[model samples]
Target: MHSHPDDKSLRDLLREQWTVAPVRNPGFRAEVWARIEAARRTPATWGAWLRLHLLGVSMVAAASIVFAGAGGGLLAGARDRHEREQLVQRYLISIDPHQSSAGEGAP
Candidate 1:
């Protein structure tokens, strides 16, 4: 809780302390802007950018390939399991038309 005698005097003091003086050198702004403009015009070439990040890109590609192989293997295993289940069902149906699936003796 500030108990300032007046708001105008306090605001004036703050402005005097915190305000940034303009650059006296007229060419300073122009020099900075020229460098920024030059950077934008040339830009980083794709070849140079890719060269800098080649390791990361290669790692991502390898991970993708590994995940694809793992997914394919999982699908193959599931398919084999389903086929085996179907074969077992067929065998049971053929062997036991009257045989209870619960191993109960048919009357």
Candidate 2:
């Protein structure tokens, strides 16, 4: 038989309620608010933000364009057709011995 009780678990200890005290210093809030206001008023900060946003939008647009182009079978069909034409031309050229001979009427 167990002589000692089981140890109180962390969960049991955390189950008790706790009170949190507010920050005593008011200057921290005031300084933070001032910085927020400064950021809002700064044209340079706003411009940088806008530029970053535009760059992100441009990247998304470019990726979407590439996806749409490839997904629509445009590039694939064109590449296949080009390859087929190249193969046909190669076959034609290979069969034509006169075309490969250097200097006309040599052999």
Candidate 3:
């Protein structure tokens, strides 16, 4: 049988009641309340959260907008290239439907 310091078996202990002392010293409550008040006076702010988590995303988004505004000509070049390729494909299809551009023989 399991026994406590008083050598009382758990079953025997069940019939008796006991008092529990305070778990902490008297000032522990007041000190905890003071710490809580201090924390309330200076709450953890969102500035750190913004700087750590959102800053990279915000920077990338801002850079994207800036590049779009200032370097939008890049897209124009890509569009022109696409149009040129389409024109070439049409011309090749019309002029040489069977001849490969690589000059390979067709069976």
lDDT of each candidate versus the true structure? 0.80, 0.71, 0.71
Q: Which wins on TM-score, candidate 2 or candidate 3?
A: 2
Better of 1 and 3 by lDDT: 1
After superposition, candidate 1 runs with Cα above 4 Å error:
1-49, 98-100, 103-107
TM value for model 3:
0.30
Clashes of each: 0, 0, 0
* TM per prediction: 0.49, 0.31, 0.30
**lDDT of model 1 at position 46:** 88
Error of 3 at 74 (Å): 1.0
Worst 10 residues of 1 by lDDT: 98-107
Model 2 stretches with alpha carbons more than 4 Å out = 1-21, 25-27, 38-52, 74-107
lDDT tens digits, residue span 79-98, model 3: 98878777776677688885
lDDT of 3 at 15: 52
- Candidate 2 lDDT tens digits, 1-107: 54334546644555565557686886998999999999786667766767758888889999999999888798789889878766765665688755544323322
